[model samples]
Target: MNIKSLLLGSAAALAVVSGAQAADAIVAAEPEPVEYVRVCDAYGTGYFYIPGTETCLKIEGYIRFQVDVGPDESGPSSWDAFTRGQVQFTAKSDTEYGPLTGVIVLQANADNATFQDTILDSAYLDIAGFRAGLFYSWWDDGLSGETDDIGSPVTLHNSIRYQYESGDFYAGISVDELEDSPFYNGETPNNVGVAVGLGGKAGAFSYQVTAGYDTDNEAGAVRAMGTVAVGPGTFGLAAVWASDPGAYYNAAEWAIAAEYAIQATDKLKITPGAQWYGNYGVVNGATDADFGSDDAWKVGLTVDYQITDNFYAKATVNYLDGDDIDDVTTGYFRLQRAF
Candidate 1:
């Protein structure tokens, strides 16, 4: 070959080798992928997080099935027949923002239109001691009175809330609206209220008081509840008082509940509880107050077993008495697996 052609070929080979080396260097300098941690707020109010991170995401929920053996056996009997509750799908996210910590939640239920319709249960943004968004009403725990029998009280309402901590005492205040359904016309505009709660714990005893108001109609209520651990068991009591000037028969009502939990074994727990309420105007009108006054009572027993950190089984039986109303009985058996 000619010298000029050989020189040109040599230069081309060198340029190709340089181009390949440059591509290799670029690949080596690529940014590493970020690793993230997950967080979840499941099984009610507790929040859990994964290790080694500031940002976390968690998913949790459960399913429940109920069997009813009412006063008449021939009246109704079958599987997928009685009343099947919905499955809850809840997610939580936690992160740090400058000097503040932020938490957000999204929860909903599946299959049951009676309770929820893939709703935004809690769409709140919380940071430090303040929160604002859509969430559960502050005064609702006692006013709902649904008892988790057929529905959940996780009503997503608009609200703004604040929490403060001092020493061992913690307090919170919230202003929000909630569903006053099955009473006063379910179509009524959201009822507004202000809720206040205070809680403190020392040793084995913990107590909390939750109260609220809706001044427009002289409608307001309050709740006081506490729990104590005694020996191998725990006991709790709650009382609620509410008044609705808009009602006719009885304008006021109150409810009291007591519960006891005993750990029969390391994996087994038994909880027995009872609740009594009087002057439940709405429910009174719905059921037959035909046999007695507007008084109602319920007795319940729940057994739970934790097979593992991710698996559990729960069975519950509730006997509700509205006096003269068929003595509604609800029993639930549920098995849940967590991820």
Candidate 2:
């Protein structure tokens, strides 16, 4: 044990193996600061940002296929085919009291076999502009064509609404629950509907007016519409009035409509429509108090095409004539895919 005690135990075993290799090269955690998924553009495009929660979300959907040919509804020039699917989910945030929203939609119909279960095409809640539960009301906001049949076959339900907007003006009101309308055949009771709306837009025009009331057959309805921006597209007009047979328009005791939407390029579109009724009184499925004398008329043509970025295709054709109704010619053909 001479040479200075073996060089002082080999310099203390190389300083204890260099302090265990600098404590095994240090780093035990750092991968946990990731949060990724963010793009919420404040609720405009596809949305996102739900990961740790500033709420924002969006999901969209569509799937459809259709074919139909008519003659007073599949009894004279019959043809049919159908498929459908839909989905939606939206959420937003921005507290204080203005931007907060929620929505849900689900739909399915593949006729007779599978996919017949899901159905709740809307579930709502909106804020600031107030809203609640189910949806679709305002007499279904008609007038874009497919040969106008002004509305009131029960456009969804359960509601409570309110709205207001400035600048371009706006207004709304609702309080529905039409005891399962479709013109309620269980004879009266289970009613209470009311809706009102007013709209606006200027420069290139736009307008809307609506009203409805069906306090258990105390009857009521009204509608109005307008549009302009002539030349390459847009031109419209609409009117409706009712006072009987309850629940919104009841298929006319007064009606009028017209349209012209032509884009024809950048992926096609075309529309041409007309409608006139005046004491029409629809009766397709029983339960009625009718409206007035009887008279009807329609004419239509519609087309749309855009085969990318969300996909689409549509077709329409119509011709109807009436007075206790019967003359017919109808149409449909469609395809869709969206996201």
Candidate 3:
């Protein structure tokens, strides 16, 4: 009787323990899906985040320098260095009211007294299509194409901009601040501009028109640009005009540019372009007059080779047509990384 009872009790206990172990194994074997961060590379300084998560912050930027050689052949030759190292933080959080977005961008090229030392490039807020704070002017919305540069040979400016888009049509309004001076009085003048753009499979075309008044002068202008893709090659055109030139009286400025590129191989790309600048007036003997000869133009050619997806070498030459016109040749080697 003792042996049978002991054996039965031991078997019952073993069965209970086996059932508990099986339950634990089943729980441990179940797999759960992993969450991943979302990365967007379509826009400037792409963003990163966890999918379906709240606004995640992202930072991206680049550094570049170039060596310049004067075109006078015997003229002074030196290395010109420039850099744009920026960390742009952005967030887009969903709220019961709606979606809100914020951005802060800071950049520099060492320190100099030429202009403001710490140039706050961009800081702004956006809700849907409405935007407010310092931003790019509508007249230069096309500037995005040259993201590598603040605004081409020039740096960026602060302005209040509003943007909206529907289908293939887009438009925006930008109100900017103009420096104060005798012509602009001691008060900063407000300048406003509007932009309209159309994009489709054939490529994209955008035009911007602006008008505003300062203390003692009025300014207005129009600019148009387009891009076309031909097989593996691409071409682009840009035209600009202004009525009240700041340097010349009643001076009108106009420019035209075109570029073509081809992939000679998997690692090499060659782009050649020419630009023309025409002016209407000049400041001669303290008086503003139509000098006609004051008009200027520029032409450039570039060749770039990709050592790897993140590294590249480029060479460029530019010819300027003006009173002190000079040819400029530049070479650059750069490395980049992305996350």
Candidate 4:
């Protein structure tokens, strides 16, 4: 009888201890999985998908240092040396209609003794070949060398543009917003510019012709350029005609420019170019007496060298002569690193 009673007491104590241990035990829940960044090659290199989104983003930019020297020592004809850095972000994704893309570019610069404010250089959206926002217009396209001034008075503008491409044939049109002049009178109305271009390539030859009109000034400009591959070089010809002094092509009433860029070596190119202008000093208008109707001409040599995969150096020297102004020498040396 005593042995039976002792066994019952030990069993009750063990059961109580087991219940206590069960109550004190802690349970841990599993953790959520992590999402990783993925490479997106559908667009191009250096693009990756956002951790939780379908969109892909690419970041790229370039840093450039340039020294510009001109004849005069003071005023507008003085020299300018500057360092500039730019960063660009491009986001892209596929949609029902087509590929949707957005781009933003920021730039900072130090010119001469002044540190300029950082600015938004370009921001635009493109979808199905339609583009909008602030960007370089189609008129900014020029020859391969820097010896030619072949763009609007203000090359950058808030614009809406559409482009279409088929094989080697392409075309584009733009409506650009023009900024008010510093001499704006309260009665001066707002202004806008319109431009259109058509281009094509055939074997060793390619050409583009573009026209622009300034609504405020009631003036228009037309430009045509062509390039052909010849032996180890490319020969380019460009001509521009303007009805009067306007925003798009005021460098001259009419101008003719030409250049032959020779690939002297795998890493070096040499280009000698020339330009002749009719009524070059008529930049402002018939009202601005400072710029006369004198003719001008320029000849220049440009050199480009690739130092490394992402580094390049360029230099150009030009001599200018006009009926009203004395002969002058001007050029610039630039180094750029791009990624």
Per-model CA lDDT versus the true structure: 0.58, 0.82, 0.52, 0.85
Using TM-score, give the best candidate's number.
Answer: 4
Per-residue lDDT tens digits for candidate 3, residues 116-159, read 24467888888877777766544334422221111111113455
Winner on TM-score between 3 and 4 is 4
The alpha-carbon lDDT assigned to residue 236 of candidate 2 equals 91
Candidate 1, position 318, lDDT: 76
Which residue runs does candidate 2 get wrong by more than 4 Å? 1-16, 19-24, 30-49, 54-65, 71-85, 102-126, 130-137, 141-148, 152-209, 212-326, 329-339
Q: How close is candidate 2 to the true structure, as a TM-score?
A: 0.34
List, in order, the clash count of every candidate structure.
3, 0, 2, 0
- The local lDDT score (0 to 100) that residue 23 gets in candidate 1 is 83
Ranking by TM-score: 4, 1, 3, 2
**Residue 194's lDDT in candidate 2:** 79
Tens digit per residue, CA lDDT, model 1, 85-153: 233333334436422333344434443345444444456666777878876653444311223221113
lDDT comparison, 3 vs 4, better candidate: 4
RMSD of each: 7.2, 19.3, 8.4, 3.5
Candidate 2, overall lDDT?
0.82
lDDT of 1 at 297: 82
Give candidate 2's error at residue 194 in angstroms. 16
- The window of 10 residues in a row where model 4 has the poorest summed lDDT is 180-189
**Candidate 3: where are CA atoms >4 Å away?**
1-53, 68-77, 96-98, 111-118, 141-155, 180-216, 246-252, 280-292, 323-339
The sequence of per-residue lDDT tens digits that candidate 4 reaches over residues 1-339 is 999999999999999999998895687878899888899999979999988999999999999999889866335667778899999999999999799999999999987556577899999999988999989876788888877776776778888989998999989898888774221112243588899989999999999999998877766899999999998999999999887666777777889999999999999999999999887855443344223478989999999999999999999999999998889888889999999
lDDT (Cα, 0-100) at 243 in candidate 3: 56
User: Would you give me the overall lDDT of model 1?
Assistant: 0.58
Q: After superposition, how far is residue 203 of candidate 4 from its true place, in Å?
A: 1.4
